[model samples]
Target: MEKHSNVKSRRKHISPVFHLQTKKEEDQHITKEVIKSVRRTGQLNLSSRHIATVPEKLFSIYDAEDENTVDWDFGKPKKEEDAWWNINPLSHLDLSSNVLSEIPAQIGMFQDLLVLNVIFGIII
Candidate 1:
């Protein structure tokens, strides 16, 4: 009987640990490609990702270039389409069905944001 109780207790503890590890891995899987796509399309859908907090990288997607890299093409004129001003600003964000507890104040930085979907979620 003591061994049975011990086994149950261990199983319960292991279950939460495993769940936490899986959540951590899923959170880390939010890759640079996703961010780049969002930057280009001005839309981000992170629904049902089990994310408790918004990733910090999303906040700086517009200025992701390294400051140390110097553009040596001073002689060449910049193209209109390739200009930084041409990039699409973040206008839509879908964070529904996530485990988010509070919307970060940084979200307000997206001045061009037109659609923010937080349905089926709770925000404090």
Candidate 2:
């Protein structure tokens, strides 16, 4: 009985450790470069980014200004195929291996999304 009590007391002092991030830290995982790639490829792999919440920009990346819009060369004529409107729409989103608690309602905006891999993550 004394041994059981001592074991229980020892376990009480041992608390599980968790890695918490600030709002800025969590948002840092999603950058302009990442958005650009996703827009071009139509696939976003945000796995293992430790993000608790999905960034709003991820949902509306098609409307967001990108390098092509801002850094256009006026000296040369632009190609029609390279236009921002020609970019591929986001279709595949991989949010696996993350710490997401709940998927945002904005995710529904991804009408073109074909694959949303949320495996190995906590969504509750």
Candidate 3:
């Protein structure tokens, strides 16, 4: 029996192409970017896929009082069947373990609150 060398050794060809566009159209095509912050928390792990890599723009919101929890700490939630994605994406949030008697009306500051964690604490 002979082994077949099926691998092609040639590198694929490439073409350098450029398309013309109007300034207004080009500006419209570009999506606005949200502020990003790098976190070094030990417990949180990166997701297999990142929203940042999505074709469209994405943003993040975080709970101030959380330390553990990956899914809640990393990415923003997708819009539900009825709900829709917001113009400003809220990708990260850390509303962890800082439970209060009531959530403040000011919570609306986080316009894109995709990951909102509300952990109740033991008061013993």
- TM-score per candidate, chains pooled: 0.68, 0.69, 0.24
Instruction: Specify the highest-TM-score model's number.
Output: 2
lDDT of 3: 0.31
Query: Which RMSD values do the candidates have, in order?
Result: 5.8, 4.4, 19.7
Residue pairs in steric clash, candidate 2?
none
Query: What's the true lDDT of residue 67 in model 3?
Result: 60
Query: What lDDT does each candidate get?
Result: 0.73, 0.78, 0.31
Writing each residue's lDDT as its tens digit, candidate 1 over 29-121 gives 456777667666888888877666776667777774678977778653365544565678899988897667778899999999999888887
The stretch of ten residues in a row with the least summed lDDT in candidate 1 is 15-24
For residues 1-124, could you state the per-residue lDDT of candidate 3 as single tens digits? 1223323322234432423334343233223221222222111212222111111211222332236743443344543321223223443443333312344455566554556444342112
What ranking of all candidate models by TM-score puts the best one first? 2, 1, 3
For candidate 2, write residues 32-64 as lDDT tens digits: 788767767899888887777776557556774
